[model samples]
Target chain A: MDFSSKLLEQAVDEVSQLPGIGKRTALRLVLHLLKQPESQTVQLSEALLNLRKNIKLCENCFNISDTQLCEICANTSRNSEIVCVVEDIRDVMAIENTNQYRGLYHVLGGKISPMDGIGPSQLTIKPLIDKVQAGKVEELIFALSSTLEGDTTNFYIFKQIERLEVKTSTIARGISVGDELEYADEITLGRSITNRIPFENSLKN
Target chain B: MDFSSKLLEQAVDEVSQLPGIGKRTALRLVLHLLKQPESQTVQLSEALLNLRKNIKLCENCFNISDTQLCEICANTSRNSEIVCVVEDIRDVMAIENTNQYRGLYHVLGGKISPMDGIGPSQLTIKPLIDKVQAGKVEELIFALSSTLEGDTTNFYIFKQIERLEVKTSTIARGISVGDELEYADEITLGRSITNRIPFENSLKN
Candidate 1:
């Protein structure tokens, strides 16, 4: 699309570089900003720049943080022995919202996706392995998604620390709490039946 | 959702301020930016700032431009006597893309919408009237949308220049090109039949 102003064109181009946003959408967004007060644009730009310039990763778990350590890793009351391994901070926020998990997290940054040129080395697998080897964690929970990439990342890390004394387990996969049995997928239904928990144990939750 | 970092939260908040972007989508976009090279964020922020600070409106037509006069207005080859009045710069671009009209444009910034607290005074209507009163334009074409606000704005402008010797016309309302007659809405289909053009006139385009 032809732009009358180079500044508008540049702004639209940069906005379209974001994931999921196309050229038309970028133009619409930029035009929206142009219509708003200049203070809105200034605040948005400053917030993005400040975030990029000063955001830090937790020294312990590699989660995004303002300080050297993330809140989860720094909390003393939380269980340090049981560490949940996941894809990124979004998962951390998801689990945290549940108010159920009290253990710390080890953010893998991303899963092992060879199709995307992301191997085990590209993730935070080494730091997690080192943490497990140091005998700080007693149990390591694999809370990654059930996709092929998630399994590959989980298996790769499991192989590295299989000889250690750490207890390893994956999150349970089954029909969601409110979902009906008729709507459940075949593989999930089969697994749910095969790995059915004891009746008394289901009541415990 | 809780963010691990305050910077991340701030960025997400600002991004969600945009139309159609919610908190979850904002977080996803912000996280995507975090994964990318820092330079990407810097460039996006800088581009927005530059556009907001340096972008100008065309002095003649009030279209968004980098200079005092837009490209169309600066070109002497185009017909200055015939002006198509539009709601905003996007309409100007759309009309330019058609390549059918060789006349210049007069961008009204926005239509008069009292529901949105937008009055004619808030738009560039006064300058447009002043231009018409100066005898610079021989014909004024109302190319605004067919919405209520568009009609109100058009009528208001027409009343202001009713005593002038200039000719006033509105863009034809009809079924879109390549659209089937069966699928056309009642109003558009009815209007198309009532205002049907001669076969030879239609063939001319």
Candidate 2:
């Protein structure tokens, strides 16, 4: 698209470089910023710049934080012995919102996706293995998604710590609570049936 | 969603302020930026800030520009006597992309929408009228969208210049060039039938 101003064009070009935004959407967003108060743009730019410049990763969990350690890692009340291993901070937020898990998290940053050139070394797997080997963790729960890369990463990490004393487990795979049985995928349904628990155990949650 | 870091939270909040972006998409975008090189964020932030701080509006046509006068308004080859009235710069860009019209443009910034508390006085309607009154324009074409607000704005401007010698017209409304007749909306089809152009005239384009 032909833009009247170079500044406008540059801004739209930069915004469209984002993962999902296209050129037209970027133009619309930039135009919106133009129509708004100048302070809005200033605050947005400052917030993004400050975040990129000053943001930190938790020393223990590798989750994003503003200080040396993240809030969850810094908290003394949460159980640090049991770490839920997952891909990125979004998973951490999702599990935290459930309010059921009391254990801390170890953010893997990403899965072992060879197609994307991301191997086990690109993730935080070594630090996690070090934690387990140091005897700081009692139980390690693999909370990654059920994709092939997720399973590969999980298996890779499990193999490294299998000889150690730490107990290893994975999050359960099952049909959603309110979903119909007929709609569940075959593998999930079969696993849910095979791993069935007592009726009293279901009522406990 | 709960964000672990205040810096990350503020960045997400600011980004979500853009139109059509929600908190979840905002978080995803922020995380994506965090994963990319720091220079990427710096360039994006600087581009936005520079655009908002230094952008200019063309004095003649009110289109966005980096100079006092826009490129189209500055061009001597374009027909200044024939001015196409549009709602915003997007319309100008769309028309420019067509490469069919040689006339200049007069951007009204927005249409007359009372529901949104926008009136003719809030737009660039006065400057447009002044241009016509100064005997600089021979023909004025209304190219705003075929909406209630657009029609109101067109009629309002037509009334102001009706007594003058300048001729006034509106862009044609019809089924799109490649659209199927069966799928065309009733109102557009009816208007297309009512305002059908001469068979010979249609062949000229």
At residue A51, give the lDDT of candidate 1.
Answer: 93
TM-score of chain A of each: 0.97, 0.96
- Show where candidate 1 strays beyond 4 Å: none
lDDT of 1 by residue, B1-205 (tens): 7888889999999999999899998998999988899999999999999999998999999999999999999999999999999988789889999899999899998899999999999999999999998999999999999999999999999999999989999999999989999999999999999999999998877
Error of 2 at A27 (Å): 0.3
A28-99 in candidate 2: lDDT tens per residue?
Answer: 999899888999999999999999999899999999998898889999999999999999999999999999
Q: Compared with the true structure, what per-residue lDDT tens digits does model 2 show for residues B1-205?
A: 7889999999999999999999999999999999899999999999999999998889999999999999999999999999999988899999999999999999998999999999989899999999999999999999999889999999999999999989998999999999999999999999999999889998987
Q: With candidate 2 superimposed using the best TM-score fit, by how many Å does residue A105's alpha carbon deviate from the native?
A: 0.5
Cα TM-score of candidate 2? 0.97
Candidate 1: chain B TM-score against the reference chain B: 0.97
B96: Cα error in model 1, Å: 1.1
lDDT of candidate 1? 0.93
**What is the C-alpha DockQ of each candidate?**
0.89, 0.90
